[model samples]
Target: MSEGLSAARQRDLLIATTASAVITDATLLPFFPKLFATAFGVEDPRHVGLYLAATCLTVMLALPVWARLERRWSTLQLLVVGQLGAGGLAIASHLTTELWSFWACTLTMIVFKASYLLVYPYVMRLVPKASHAGVIGLLTVIVHLGGILGATLGGWVLEHHDPRAAYLVMAAGDFLQMGVSVYLLRRGARAPSPEPAHEGVPEVVEASADDPAPALPPIPQRLSPLVRLGLLMAVVYFSAFITRPFFVEYWGTRSSLDGELVSGWVFAIPALASLVALGVQHMGWSRPGSLYKWLALIALGVAIQATPLPAAIVVGRFIYGWAAFRGLVDLDLALFEISPPERYAEDYSHMNLCQQGGVLIAFWIAGLAVNAGGLVQPLWIALGGFVVGAGVFAAYGSRFVAAAPSEGKAPEEVAPC
Candidate 1:
C-alpha cells in the first residue's frame, strides 16, 4: 500500500489529518455546549443537550453520504470541499442573531466538517499493516492533545474575550484545513495514485470458516465486518462520552473552581493523562494482552468520578485517560488491520457512523440526566454503559484477538473484523 507514496508525503498527510482533527476538536467536542450557551444565550440544560445531540446527529447523517462519495473522489478532494463549506457556515453562523438561524448554520457546518472523518482510514491505507498499532497510537496522541489544546483555547477565549470570537477561530481553522487539503490533493495528482483502486466494496467476511462462531446474540451473520465493528464502537463511544457534555457543570457543583480556563484544564485531565500514557504505552511490559483490563479500568475511573469528592474526580480522570488511550488504540488497530485497502473510507465511515450514534445518544442522555437529577447522575449512567460496552467487546473480542499481530503472519491475513 505504501509503494507509490514517498515518506515525506506520508508525514504531510498526517499533518493535514492532525490539523483537521484539532480544528474540529477545538470547535465541536463536548465543551461546545458551553460555547453554544454563551453564543446563543441558551440557558436551559435541555436546550444545550438537544443542540449538541443535533450537532452529532449531523455527523451521523453526513458520514454515509461522504462514504459513498469516496468512490468518485479522493479523501483530500472531499476534505477541500468540506472545509470550505464548514468555514463559510461558521462565518454565516457568526453573523446570525437569531438562535434558530445560528443553530441551523452551525449544524449544517458539522455535516461538512464530517468530511474530516475520512482522514483516518485514508492515512491508514498508505501505511503497512505491521505499523498499524504505532500509527494508531500516534494518532490517538494527536487527538487527545488536540482536545487539551482546544479546551484551553476555547476556555481562555470564553474567560477574557467574547465567546463569539471562537467562531472566527473555528472559521480560521476550517480555512487552514482547506488549504492543506488543497495542497495535498494537487501534490498527489502529480504523483501516482496511492493504491490500485477496488472496483466496488470487496466481499470480505469477518468470522472464520474453520472456527465455529461463538454463541453471540441474534445479530445477523449477513452484517459486514465493518458493521459489526461499528456496533461495538457505538457501545464504547456511548460509555466513554456519556460523561463529557456535563463535566464542566459537574465540576462547578463539586468544586468552587470559578474560571472557565480552570474548568477547561480539569476537563482536559484525560488528555493530560494521554501524554503520560505515551511514555510507557509503547513499552512491552506496559501493554495489555487483551481489551478487558483497559475496559475494567475505564469503568473504575467512571465509578470513582461518580463520587462527590473533587480529589477523587481528578484521580478518576487520570485513570480513565490512561486506560482509554490504550483501549481505543487497540480497538482502532483492530478496525484498520481487518479493513481492505479498497474499502478503507467506506468501512471506516460505517464504523464511525455507529460511533457517532453512541456519542449522539450520550449527549442527549447526559444533558437530560443533569437537568432531571444532578451532575453525578450521568456518571452512574456512564458506568453502566461502560459495563455493557465491556460485555460487547467480550463477545466481539475474539475477532480482534484472532487478528492480533503474531510471530510470522501479518494481522491482515485474518478476515476483516
Candidate 2:
C-alpha cells in the first residue's frame, strides 16, 4: 500500500535484503556442537544445546523491541543499525577467549541481528497477495541453500583452521548486510517522493486473481488470525528443529567416514532434499491442498531417521526436507493470504517470536535428551512433536473455517483479538 517507492525499487530492495538473509543464515546456522567446541573448547552436548537455546532466547527478547521501533524508522534504517552492531559484536566475540565473555558478546550480537528479520514481512508487503506462496517458497529454498553452504563452509573452517575463525565469517557477513542496507536507504532517499495520500486512510490491496484461497478457516473472533497461525507454526517448527542441533554429531556417530567435512555434507542432506523438492515445485506438480499429507510424510521421515543405519538417516533427511519445505511454504502462504497488507510487519514479528520460542524449547530439550539417552533420542522426541502438532492443527481447523472472513474482507474485521 505504500507508494513511496515504485514496484521496480521494491523488487530491488527485496533482492538485496534476501541476499543479506542468505548470508545471515550461512553465518549463523553452523552454530552448534562443532562451532561451539571450536570457539570455546566446550564439547558437551548439554552445554552446547544450552548455548544454542540461549541465542534463541536472545532473539526472542529482542524481536518485539525491534518490531516496536518500526513505528519510528524504516526497516532499512533499522537494518543498518542492526548490522553495524551485530558485525562489531561478532568481531568482539572473535577477540574473546573466555567462555562467559564470548557468550556475552555473541548473545548481544543476536539482539541486534534480530532486526534483520523485518525483511521477511517488509518484502511480503511489496508484492501482490497472490505471489505470497511463490515468494515464501523461494525464501524457504534460500534458507536451505544457506544451510548447505554454511555447513560446508563451517566444516572446512573447523577442519583446516581454528574453529573460532567462523566468527570472522559471521562478522564479514554482517558487514556485507550492513552495506546492502545502507545502499538501499540511500537509493530510497534519492528517489522522488510520491504525492501525499490522505491521512488516517488505510489502503486495501485487492487479492491477486490467481491467488489461492486461505488454506484453513479463520480462528475465533476473540483471537487474531496471526496469533492462531503463529501458535500452530510454533508446534510445527518445534517438531522439525528438535533434531537440528545434534544432527552433525549424530552423523559422526553412525558413519565410518568421520571428518567434519563428511559430517557437514551429511548434515546438509535436508538442504539437498529441498533442492529436489524445489525442482518438483517448479514443475507445478506439488499439490497445494496436501498439507495433511506433508505432515504425515514428515512424521514418517523422522521415524526413519531414528533407525540405526546411516543410509536410513540419509534417506530420511531427503524425505523430511521435501515434506518440510512444502509444509513450511504452505504455512507461510496461509499466513500472508489471511493477513492484510497494512499489518504485514507487525504480524510477521509476532509470528517469528512464536517460532523462536518453539526452537528455544526444542534446543533446551535436545541437549537434555542427548545427555540422558545419547544422540538418537531427539529424533523420537521430534516425531512426537509432529504428532502433537498435527493434532493441534486438526483440532483448530474447524474453528478457522467457522470464523473465516468473507471474500475481500480483512481478517482483522472478523478475527480481531
Candidate 3:
C-alpha cells in the first residue's frame, strides 16, 4: 500500500501542513475567556473578540509581505522559519503580565504562523488536477477534525490547568510543525517551483517591436470570480465568528452548562457535522449544486441560533454544523474551479486575505456588540450578514468557473536528496 501510494510522502506532508492550520485555533477556542482574564484581568469574553480582531489585523498587514517572501524562499525553508519563530513567540506570549505585552507577542506570532498558508500551493504540484478536490476535501476534514480534537482537549486542559497552558499546547504544535519541515528539508524533497506570474498588483504587458506581447486583462478582471466568491464565503465565516468566541459564555447565560469545557461540546457539534459531510463526500456524494442549498440552510441555522430560545440554539447549531461543512467544501471547490495551478499560492493568498478580512470585521463587531450591547447581538449580525452573503453567492451561481483549467499533473520528477 505504501509503495502503491505514489506521492504518499508528499501527501503526508500536506496533511501535516494542514494540521498546523487548525491545531492552534482549535486548542485556543475554548479558552478565550480565561485568556481575557489573564491578559486584561477580566472574565468577559468580549475582550477575547477584540484581541482576536487585533491578531487578525496583524495577519492582514503581513499577508503581502509573506506573499513576497514566498517568491524569494522555498516553501520548506519558509515553513521551518515560520514554525520555529511562531513557536518561540507563542511560548513568550505565555509570560506576558499585561494585555499589551500579550498582544505584542501574539501579533508577532501570527505573522509567523501565517506561513502555513503557502503549503497548499506547493503541494498542488505533487498531485493530479482530478485529485485536487479530493485532496482539498481531505485537507478540510483534517482542519475540522484538528479543531474538534483540539477543542475537546483544550477544554480539558482549561479544566485542570491555566489559560496559559493552551498557549503551551499551541507552541508544541509549532515545534511539531518545525520538526516535520526539518525532516522534509533533510530528505531534500522539494515542491515543484513555479515562476512568478505577477507581482503585487496585476501588471500590464508592454509590447515591443521585436516581440509583441499579448494584451491581457488587469488584476481585477483576472480575480473577479474568485473575489466575489471569497467575499461571500467571508461573510458567512465572519458572521459565524461574531458569535463563536462567546459560545461558552452564551451557553452559561442561556443554559445550565457548568463550564466552558461543557460548552466546548456545543462548538464541536458543527465540526462533527463537517466530518460527516467529509465521509459522504468521500463516498462520491459531492455535488456542486449543493452549494446553493447549503448557503440557504446556513443562513437559516444562523437565524435560529440567534433567537432567544435555548432549544433553538442547540437545534440550530446542529444544522449549522452540516451546512458549514458543505459550504466550506463548496467555497474551496469554487476557488479550485477558477484557480491557476501555476499560481495557487499567489491566488489563494489573495483569497485568504479576503477571508481574514471577514474574520477581522466579524471580530470587531463581536467586540462591539458583546462589549457595549448584548450577548446575542453578534448572532443577529451573523443572521443578517450570512443571508446577505449567501444571497450574493446564489445570485452569482449561474457563472462560476476557472477562466482556464489547471494543467497540473503528477510531478515529472522531484528534487531528491
The true-structure Cα RMSD of candidate 1 reads: 4.9
**Each candidate's TM vs. the true structure?**
0.86, 0.87, 0.85
- The CA lDDT at 139 in model 3 is 77
Question: Which tens-of-lDDT digit does each residue in 39-103 have in candidate 3?
Answer: 46787655677778887778776765776787888888888998899989889988777777888
Candidate 2 per-residue lDDT, tens place, 1-417, comes to: 245657557656666556655755564464567666766678898897888889988988898889889878888888889989988998898788899898899899989999988888777766666687778878888788877888788778778877667778888888887887776676673222222334654445557989996666554656666667777778888888889888877877888887877787877888889988989879988656556668778998999998889899889988998888888987888767665666666667777878888999899999999999998999999998888767666655634322324334544632211
User: What lDDT does each candidate get?
Assistant: 0.75, 0.76, 0.72
For model 1, how does the per-residue alpha-carbon lDDT over 167-238 read when each residue is reduced to its tens digit?
788888888878777766655632223454346624434557888867766556465555566677787898
The numbered model that scores best in lDDT is 2
Candidate 1 local Cα displacement, residue 22, angstroms: 1.6
Runs of candidate 1 exceeding 4 Å displacement: 1-7, 27-30, 189-224, 283-285, 399-417
Q: Model 2: number of clashes? A: 3
Candidate 2, poorest ten consecutive residues by summed lDDT: 189-198
Which runs of model 2 end up more than 4 angstroms from their true locations? 1-6, 27-31, 189-221, 395-417
Error of 1 at 345 (Å): 0.4
Of the pair 2 and 3, which is ahead by lDDT? 2
By TM-score, is 2 or 3 better? 2
Model 1 lDDT, residue 347, Cα: 65
